[model samples]
Target: MNATGEGEAAPRQIEVLASVRGRVMCMDSAYDVDEANRGRDVCVNSSYCGVLPARFIAEHRPRAAIGMDCGVGPEGSAIAGLWYLEALGIPAAVADVMTAHLGDGVHLYHHGIVSFANQPALDCGVTAGMAVREAAALLLEHDPVAAAASEITNRTVMETTPDGRSVVAADSIAFGTSEDTDRNVLVTAGHTGRSAVPYLRRCRPFGFICSDGGRGLNDSGMAGLYLVEADGLAGATVDARRARMGSGLSHYHDGIISAVNALAAAAGVEIGMACPQAAHHLLHRRPPTASPVP
Candidate 1:
């Protein structure tokens, strides 16, 4: 897909986890897939295999793509993306939320256990319970196809807090812009992983919240909180069970707090508070000056 449009420079490389016959990349969100690495395989810690992310990967036409199953929540919405990719004849699969941290791609590659595989992936020797590295090897054996139209989901300003800050709901933090700055509070449906740190550090929103991804394996799901806290961003994650993993609107309306960084705690966010309440406190307060990055 020409989503990047004519003359768009190829996007810079995201973290490359391995390079065999083809590159094996790991990213925080599926939106990280781009024209630059069009045919490489990727594993993202978006915590859900929904069509939104699938479309992002399919748009780039990767040889294969893998994402977390996110407990295959209500209506199986979490793993629904697998079928979407299947229809496009792309090899795609998902790791069990329990076997790997939902937000850490490196962990997914090294420790994840495949819980589901679409027919295309299955045809290439990918199977449930297989090691991610083994599945990625099989993925490389598949041929890349022409790009499909990519769908970019839009973020919504759910409400303007009493203090004038916008409380934005985004299907993924990947939609955030530098304009969000200290003027907006973001509630995203993606996981809080280490890959999220760089994006948050760059965007510098007033405050932010995302999913805990069931706090899977070594608490890797919310691991980005401390990393961002070091940058002085007040951040938190809501329990995956309390809200859908891939819907920001569901997060804002149904989420219950699962964890909070120090800055968020200082702002009165608690583990059991409703997401709206926490977002309110975040909009009303600001973290200390973030340490300058190199």
Candidate 2:
């Protein structure tokens, strides 16, 4: 993946993307696979050129995988994950999406469908533009593993509004728990998608700062609009390059505002504004949380 269309460097480490049935889905660039990641056989990678760091995969091989295609840039050599996994005798796929997505590459999972799959994935019926979840389902059906928490999911309390709303940073809405689920101003890394609504509904925050996942435009980026409808929660999006994994929630305090909903407009969250500035604006419009059926 060439550096075009991207702004931030991908995370240098791996993080948990999901955990089900003792099988964990992990996200990372390229790094040595230590005992900490021993059983993480399902992986989502961020490295554009993986030949050097991807050597670690041979030792801690994931049975199935997903990753950014890096737009097939620089003579298409940036498709590192696909090439590496193919030789390792595993099912693997890479996104046909933009380069910005390859940075902190997990965003590619949220926005992309399978554009390219190695021999193993093709045998399982994985194809270009197939929804990511469907691809994951195929992977889980084939292989599984587990690993310890690399650390706590990255999230932060950036500011407390004068009205007492807590503004926090988080990578995914999965962190949205019943304990601290409501009336929050969340700076998050998840994309805006209807498929993601159920997850955001769990968090049920008062406002959001999310990544556009490098596909921010038209209907593809309307997930946040649908999200605000859940409870009129003001929301906005940034680029994947500006944020990665949990850091997408905490790392990019200020960056371009890509999209917004009408209520977010009423609440002062505008499209095209820097996120830090937008977060500042929404602080004044804090409204009491309305009960949502979801």
Candidate 3:
């Protein structure tokens, strides 16, 4: 029984279901875009992915946020948005699988929702299976002013691919500046945001693996978008859905894009291909791939 209608029979539209103290709860039948959710308290996002959702928090700077986790499929990419928001020091959470969508949760339209919460959200008492109304209530209990957290950590080298190439994994794009050694492989949990291109250009890695970050409304064309635009860099981004790395980047998905550079193309890479296979074609020096590239 929200402003729209009753639960299970509500129409899909961008409606301000509730608002208070410049902090409001809003809903969009489609997705939670920044341009659409400026002063919202809780965002009832019907969208199913987290891939670039945090961009809005970075830009417009909302107080807190909530959305659907989209089941965090494949490589844990969907919830990457929650991770990013938490990293940005914002309290964010998402609805679980059984309760997300526009009208499919514990009644986000009426009550609050409690699903997957980031560390920041948890710190503020946001918990899973809680009502969205309850979650919003907890958010209101905290100071409205935002806090500053630490910057994302640098990329760390997890392992070598047995063929002598280095596998560098980090949370940010600062890896290209490593003066340690020579290794052509790079992996990161960060999205392929266009801003990372310049730093990566200065710290070139022949092959790159990045996170897609759920490709949320604000993130659709940004992840790895610009990095691939540059020349001579063979790149692939793990579906943010499958790019979850709680233990670290060792679990990065090995899928590469159909798009690649001239050098990688000449070495036999193709679109919609596995990143490991693509890397084998370009950076594999000593040991050969399964079939050996002829």
lDDT of each: 0.79, 0.61, 0.56
lDDT (Cα, tens digit) per residue for candidate 3, span 1-294:
543575554443334444464444445432434644554455555544465656654465566677666667875687777777766666777776555445432254455456678767776788777877677666655643354432334345555656556666665555455542235666665666676677667777656666565555766524554445444566655555444533124334444453444445556767676655655554653322245568
Model 3 lDDT at residue 139: 61
lDDT (0-100) at residue 195 of candidate 2?
A: 58
Candidates in order, TM-scores: namely 0.50, 0.48, 0.41
TM-score of 1: 0.50
lDDT of 2 by residue, 1-294 (tens): 323545654444445445552243535554534444444445666554345545665567655666666666664576665667666666677766652355554565555566777656765667777865567667656542222333334556777867576667765666655544656767777677665677667777767777776755665754655555656566777765555534544435645777776667777777677777777666556575557978
Q: What is the lDDT of candidate 2?
A: 0.61
Candidate 1 lDDT, 1-294, residue by residue in tens: 112234533333345455565677776577777785666655444347888888878888877888889888887898899989988878889998888765566667778889988757866788888988788777876653433323333377877966667989887877678778977989998889888787788888989999998998999999998888766789999999889876788899999999999999999999999999999899888547666999
By lDDT, the best candidate is: 1
Model 3 lDDT vs. the true structure?
A: 0.56
Q: Which candidate number has the best TM-score?
A: 1
**Model 3 stretches with alpha carbons more than 4 Å out:** 1-20, 29-32, 35-40, 103-107, 111-113, 144-294
Candidates 2 and 3: which is better by TM-score?
Answer: 2
Question: How many clashing pairs does model 2 include?
Answer: 3
Question: What's model 1's overall lDDT?
Answer: 0.79
Report the lDDT of model 1 for residue 10: 32
